[model samples]
Target: MKKNIVVTGGTGRFGNHLKSISTKHKLFFPTKNQFNILNFNSMLKYFNKTKPDIVIHLAGFSRPMELHEKDINKSINLNIIGTANVTMACSQKNIKLIYFSTNYVYPGINGNYNEDDPLKPFNNYAWSKLGGECSVKLYKNSLILRVCMTEKPFIHKKAFANVKTSFMYHDEVAKILFKLLNKQGIINIGGKAQYIYNFAKKENKKVKKIYQNKNMKIKVPFDSTINIKKLQKIVKVKF
Candidate 1:
């Protein structure tokens, strides 16, 4: 059956990929003006207008990890508070909420982390995402996706040799999203566990190799690979 779906960050990287492939569902990718996640009134108004059965909450601050540290207020408002507002609005209307979280929520020391693993965010960015997860978890009708995805064309010139992760391209993830919508609770989404360099080389053979350094300015996870057995059972797609 077809249902109305509202994607909050519909104009973002992953959201754009979803729009390109979405043909079966009635999806509404409203801008911040149309559906401001930070404002409960705005969210309620939009939800009332659209009467969506599902709302994919993707509006949040991400990238340039340093920004989270530099401007904690922005991170708190957008990633934390904004998510809370969305969750509250969804709960009020009894709408299924799909939240996009990060694999960084797990302690990066161990690889193959599962959905049930205890969370310990490595950085400020991860912490903010976890904050979002807290609200969504309180809402019964919600799905939290601890995803490790990146854009296609592998923009990075030098990939980490020592670090391991399960990074899937946005376009690849977009294909399997519909199967995941009906799922509740947390689900780890990404590709097979492998060295970051190995994954990058598959897409860009010319990509150089680099190693994670302790002295590095940014916090790099040595092993943030996530186990996706649960996701595999549902979608039957090789990550």
Candidate 2:
């Protein structure tokens, strides 16, 4: 059956791709100006007006991992507190909340982390995302996607040969998103596990291969690939 849905943070990379898709359900992509997540009343006002049955919370601070380290307050306010406000609004309106999290929430080493696996965020960025997860987990009608997705065309000119990941494109994940709208609790959403160099090489042969070094400022995860068995079973599509 068709349902009314609202997507927050429609301006983001994934959210932009999501707007291009055609689905049976009606979707509303409200800009932050229209539905500011930090303002709980704004979310409630939008929900009350639209009467949506589902709210995809995609508004959060991300990108430039350095920002999280430098501006911890903004990270906490946007990703953590903003998400909590969204959850509260969703709960009051009885809307199914689908949150966008990250695969970085899992311990980097020892890949194949599942939904039930123990979490240990790699950096301050991941920690902020996990903080949002905590609030969404409280709501009974919520689905958390610990997604491993990135911009298409392989943004980086260099790929980490030593680091492994399950990086899928934003559009790829958007294609399968509608199928999992009604799912509750958390789901590990990603692609097949592969070395970063291997994944990027397929798209750009000129991409340079680099290994994680101790001198590097950023904390590189040796392996942060997530298991997508549950997602495959539901979508009936092999990754």
Candidate 3:
């Protein structure tokens, strides 16, 4: 079945990879002019005109984790309020929604956090993402993906050896996305649990291993790996 799908934030890093994938469904990567998530009228107008079957809400504030701390208003408005607006539009139009969340929603102390596990966002950015999750959770036709994926080729020169996480490349996750389109509810999406350096070294052999020492400015999660058994059972996806 070739369904009409609308993807927000089509210009972002992961969105770019998702756009390149070969899927059976019809994907619409709308520019901000066509669909501005922060504005309810614009989102609703676009939804009414396009009449898409699925809305993948990817437009939100992310990266430079410091930005969230430095400017809380930007974080709350973009990630939280923007997502709520998308959810409202999707709910009104009776469209299926797939939200892109983060694995940082889980407590960093314990590894292998499940979907039902208690959520304790380790950073302000995670808090904003969780706030977005709250709105989508209310919509029955929504699917929340707590993904722990990163950019390909390992852009960073220094990798955290002491910090462990389930890091999958953008393309790997994009490949398995179409399979999960019809699914609803929360799901942990990630790769096998491993140290950051181990995953980075696979692509960049010269990547330096650096532990989060006392001098480190930012707070990095020690262990934020999620339990992806449910995702494996659902899609049989391999990273």
Q: Which residue pairs in candidate 1 have backbone atoms (N, alpha carbon, C) closer than 3 angstroms, thus clashing?
A: none
lDDT per residue as tens, model 2, 180-215: 998998998888899999998988999999888857
Can you give the TM-score per candidate against the true fold? Answer: 0.97, 0.97, 0.97
lDDT of 3 at 141: 98
- Cα deviation at 165, candidate 3, in Å, is 0.3
Please give the RMSD to the true structure for each candidate, in Å: 1.1, 1.2, 1.2
How does residue 43 of candidate 1 score in lDDT? 91
Clashing pairs in 3: none
- Write the residue-wise lDDT of candidate 3 on 60-147 in tens digits: 9998998999999999999999999999999899999999999999998879999999999999999999999999999999999999
Give the distance in Å from residue 143's predicted Cα in candidate 3 to where it truly belongs: 0.3
Worst 10 residues of 3 by lDDT: 212-221
